[model samples]
Target: MRMNFGHLRGVHVRVFVPSSPYFPAYAQGQGPPPMVQERFQSVISQLFQYRIIRCGGAVDDDMANIIVAQLLYLDAVDPNKDIVMYVNSPGGSVTAGMAIFDTMRHIRPDVSTVCVGLAASMGAFLLSAGTKGKRYSLPNSRIMIHQPLGGAQGGQTDIDIQANEMLHHKANLNGYLSYHTGQSLEKINQDTDRDFFMSAKEAKEYGLIDGVIMNPLKALQPLAAAAEGKDQGSV
Candidate 1:
C-alpha cells in the first residue's frame, strides 16, 4: 500500500508498503493489534515532516543520520526555507556531532536552532553554528561547551597516536567556536579548557546565541527582516 502524508515547506511526502501475506489474518484481528499498527504508521508518517528535528538525548551516529537526512531533504525540496532544530542533549560522540555540524553548514536552508533544555559540548557547538542572528535558547535553558575527550587502548604507539588525534580535534573545535561565535581561538581555548556552563541569557551575552527567546515566534521576526535586508542589498 502507498500512503501520501503531510507536506513540509510544500514538499509532498509519500510512503510505500507491500501487502502482507497475513492481511486476511489482520482483517480477522488475528495478526497485530489495530492500535499498534496505527501507532507504527504514525511514527513513520512523522519522519516526513521537516519543520523540526529533535535532538533530545545523546547525539550519536543514528541521530546524526536523521539530522542530515532531514537537512538534505529540505534543501532538495526548498533550499530557501527556514528549518528549526530543537536540541536538548548532554552531548555525545564528537564524530557524530561533527557530521551534523558540517551538514548544517553545507546545507542551503537556514537552520534556526532552539536550545530547549541542555546544549552541552558538541550540542553547544551545533547550537552556536546556527545561522547568525538565528541561534536561540529558551529563557531557562542551559548551555555548555567543553574540550573534546578521548580514550585509547592497546600498545603505547596507539596511545600516542590517540593523544595526538585528541589535540587535533581540540584545535578543530576551538576553530569552529571562534568562527561561529566570533570569539578568538585564545578565548575559546580558555573557556573550554574545563566544563563551562552558562544560563541562556549569559550564553547570549557571550555570543554563543543571538538571543534568549521568551517566545520563539518573536525570534523569527528577524528572519523576515533579514530577508528584506538581503533583497534590498542585492537590488
Candidate 2:
C-alpha cells in the first residue's frame, strides 16, 4: 500500500521511505554496502512512525540554505499535500531559524510538529511554525524557549551590531509565536526574555503545544496517519 503523508502549504507531502523501491535505485553508497542496505532500512524503519526529521544544533547559514532548498523541493513535488515536521534540536542560528519560520508559514501546509527530545531556542520557533495541531514530548522530552543570543567580539561597535541583529530576530520570533500560539506578543516576549523549557504537560496547558504524545519518535508518522484518517472520516 502506498502511504501518502497528505499536504502542507499547497504542497502535497512526500516521504522518502527507506522501504520503497526508490531506495535501491537512488541510495548509492558508500551510502550502502552489501547487507548494509537491509540494516540501514531496518534502523530507519524503526524511526518511520514519525515524520521525525532532524535539524542542526543551532541556526546557521547552512540550515537556512536547507530550509529554502527543501521548501522549493516540496513545492515542486506536490502542491496539495499537508506536511508534518518532526523536530529535535538545542536550536542554532536565529537568522537561519527565522528564515525557516518564514518559509514554513508562507507555504500553507496543514502542518503539525512534534518534539521528541530537545526543541530549544529557535527550534521552538520551528515547532510553532506548524500550521496547527502541534504536539510535543511527554516524558523526558523538552521544549525550550528564550531570547536569541549572539556572538560578539571587539567592543562597543560589535555590541551595537549584535544588539541590532537581535532586535530583528526578536521581532520575527515573536510574530511567529503570537500567530500560532495565540499568546500576546508581550507575553511571549516576557516568557522568552529568559530561557524557558517546558514539560509536555506545561506546554499543553499554555497552548505551546496542542497535546502530549508519549514516545514521540516512535509514533510520529503513525499518529499523523491516524489523525489524517480521522479527519477524513469526520469530513
Can you write out model 2's per-residue Cα lDDT over 1-235, one digit (the tens) per residue?
1111111123555533233221343434435466876886676455433333345344556656755666655555665565556676667666567677777767644556666677787777787677566444445667878876655566898778866776776787777788778889999999988777687677766667776664335454533553543332111
**Candidate 1 residues 70-162, lDDT tens each?**
788888988888877778877777888888988998999888877888888888888998988777787889998888866777799978888
Give candidates' CA RMSD values in order. 11.7, 10.9
Compare the candidates by lDDT and give the number of the best one.
1
Mark the 10 consecutive residues where model 2 has the least summed lDDT. Answer: 1-10
TM-score of every candidate relative to the true structure = 0.74, 0.69
Compare the candidates by TM-score and give the number of the best one: 1
Residue-pair clashes per prediction, in order, are 0, 24
Total backbone collisions, model 1: 0
Model 2 earns a TM-score of: 0.69
